[model samples]
Target: MNDDRRVYGTDRGEDPRPQPGRVYAELVGGPLDGQLLDVTGWTPDAILDGAALITEAGAYGPGGRALYDPFPGDPSRWSWSGDTP
Candidate 1:
């Protein structure tokens, strides 16, 4: 299995910026699928950085550009309802 860590950000090397219509990324497919990746070590803001962790694409593990998937809505709010804060 691919044990390498995945970082969420932009697929392109450009610095990440959040704006209307802008896209962000997280890992999809393979072993890391559906798991939240912690990228604070490299990217302090992680997904907010909008730059690929591995610029070469597919340079490390099984995933490359093809493995990049649109980030699903944050799961932290999944269990949150009108109840508890």
Candidate 2:
């Protein structure tokens, strides 16, 4: 995983300007496949608990969420687990 990767803009209408001190994780699979997640300040416990990332491209469409879990061997990577309503 490339820690240097940063999200300057997103389809969700986030600010296009680069944010300093922002940590990112590579999102693999699901609707957010190949996307970068801002995980700055996330604790190990939070990472272990995983995340339900909001995505308009999810199975339930807009307002749906895509579940992601941290890769055991890589904290900088998150693998898709499933989708939520």
Highest lDDT: give the candidate number. 2
- Which 10 consecutive residues of model 2 have the lowest summed lDDT? 1-10
Instruction: Name the top TM-score candidate.
Output: 2
Write model 1 residue lDDT over 13-79, tens digit each, in one string: 7433333332323345443343333433344344333333232234344333223323346411111
In terms of lDDT, the poorest run of 10 residues in model 1 is 76-85
What pairs collide in candidate 1? Answer: 10-50, 10-51, 16-49
As for model 2, its CA RMSD to the true structure in angstroms is: 3.7
Displacement of the residue 14 alpha carbon in candidate 2, Å: 4.8
List runs of model 1 lying over 4 Å from the truth.
1-26, 30-36, 41-46, 55-72, 75-85
For each candidate, C-alpha RMSD in Å? 14.4, 3.7
List model 2 lDDT by residue over 1-85, tens digit each. 3333335235576663336677777888898787678778989898788899787798989898999999998978899999999
The C-alpha local distance difference test score for the whole of candidate 2 amounts to 0.77
